[model samples]
Target: MKKRYILENSKSLLVLLVLFFSSCVFAQQNNTTPIMENQFWKNVQFGGGLGLGFGSGYTDISVAPSAIYNFNEYVALGIGAQYKYLKQKDYYASHLYGGSLIALLNPIREIQLSAELEQLRVNVNLEGSNSNSLDYWNTGLFVGAGYRSGSATIGARYNVLNDKNGIYGSAFMPFVRVYF
Candidate 1:
């Protein structure tokens, strides 16, 4: 089952990469003026989120870093990676690592819409009397809308592929995104 999931995820990622690179090639060919290869880097933006929380017997820490290439004022494509750690003193501890492919559209200056495909690997270890360990992968396909200002966007997303037993625990998530 795990192997199947990994294979499926790999195929999806490969498809996305092919499409992305093909579009880049098409755009370059359509342009009459010669564009320097380094110019591509100029339009790329890098950003992500970091979180930390600890109190009592619980702790949570997360780091996610992403980069996007702005094709124009209205469209952007990006990729991100994330890592998270969670623990409950006498309960269980978990480590999650993942990656996502995201696409953003700006219909207007104030409205932003997004679609993202995310895959995560989860590992958990149970402590105490009945000790056990589990490992699995979770995938999410999210669609979202937000209010944009400058380089920031505040939004909410719904995971169309959400599963109750998955890592996020909820199909709905709120976000504050920035790219610069």
Candidate 2:
């Protein structure tokens, strides 16, 4: 299962990379941002939100904070992190990590797409191993779609990550962004 997940994720990332690079080349040749005008953060923006994420264990509340920088109107770069607490029926688990060098594509008004490669660290404490903790690192890629209007943005994302313990995960995440 882990091997299969990695294969599928690799293919998806390759497709996203091809699309991203192709769009960038097209934009450079055209010499213009795809949308005429947008209230995009002029090179830099900050965003954060609270939500629920379910996977691995059980549903839990989460806090996600992120920052984005626009290299140009059509392409934006991002770095962000998420901390989530897992509320298992019999135990609790939490993780903290951050990522860098993500990309966003906003070729049209009111719509945006994104892709990212991220590195993560996780510490898990099962009931039996409270005295002995496990630490692991991972690589992940995610894809998302969203709509933005005024100061509010909402999106849904899907992520595939390869864990250090030879496990892989596929997660579906939905999020909201507020710009000030």
Candidate 3:
């Protein structure tokens, strides 16, 4: 079952990547920051998100490690890995693991348009007499706009494939990002 999910999503992911890069290739060029040839580090960015929760009732934690490469001022491509865990006392625990591909378009300073695709596997275990684990694919496509300044970014995204138990958890997800 897991293998079928991966195989099906793999084709979809590949098609999306091809289309995304083709669009980037045709983006109109504008006067923007010039790349520093001597430093490859300058063209690369690294950042993601960390989520935490601690209390008597429930706990949630997540971490994502990401990298973005600036092909030009108007276009950037990125990738990340995500891991999330949630537990509810005497109830259930869920684990989510995924990889993401993202593209960012900056038509003007301080404004960003973004698109992302994620392929994830979610495992849910219910604590009961017949404890069982369910594994399935949770694929998400997110599109939104953002405000970017220096190394910080704030954005809101809508997941088109918003499933009730998907990774994003809702149709809308707010984001705060930093790149180094």
Best-performing candidate as measured by lDDT: 1
Enumerate residue pairs that collide in model 2: none
- In candidate 3, what are the lDDT values of residues 53-136, reduced to their tens digit? 988989999999999999788898888999999999888899999898888899997998899888888999988848577887
- Report, for every candidate in turn, its global Cα lDDT versus the true structure: 0.88, 0.66, 0.83
Compared with the true structure, model 2 gives a TM-score of: 0.60
At residue 41, candidate 1 shows an lDDT of: 83
lDDT for residue 144 in candidate 2, whole number 0-100: 84
lDDT for residue 149 in candidate 1, whole number 0-100: 92
Off by over 4 Å in 1: 1-10, 13-35, 129-131
Candidate ordering by TM-score (highest first): 1, 3, 2
Q: What 10-residue stretch in candidate 1 is worst by lDDT?
A: 29-38
Clashing pairs in 3: none
User: For every model shown, what is its TM-score relative to the native structure?
Assistant: 0.85, 0.60, 0.79
- RMSD for each of the candidates: 3.8, 8.3, 6.4
Better of 1 and 3 by lDDT: 1
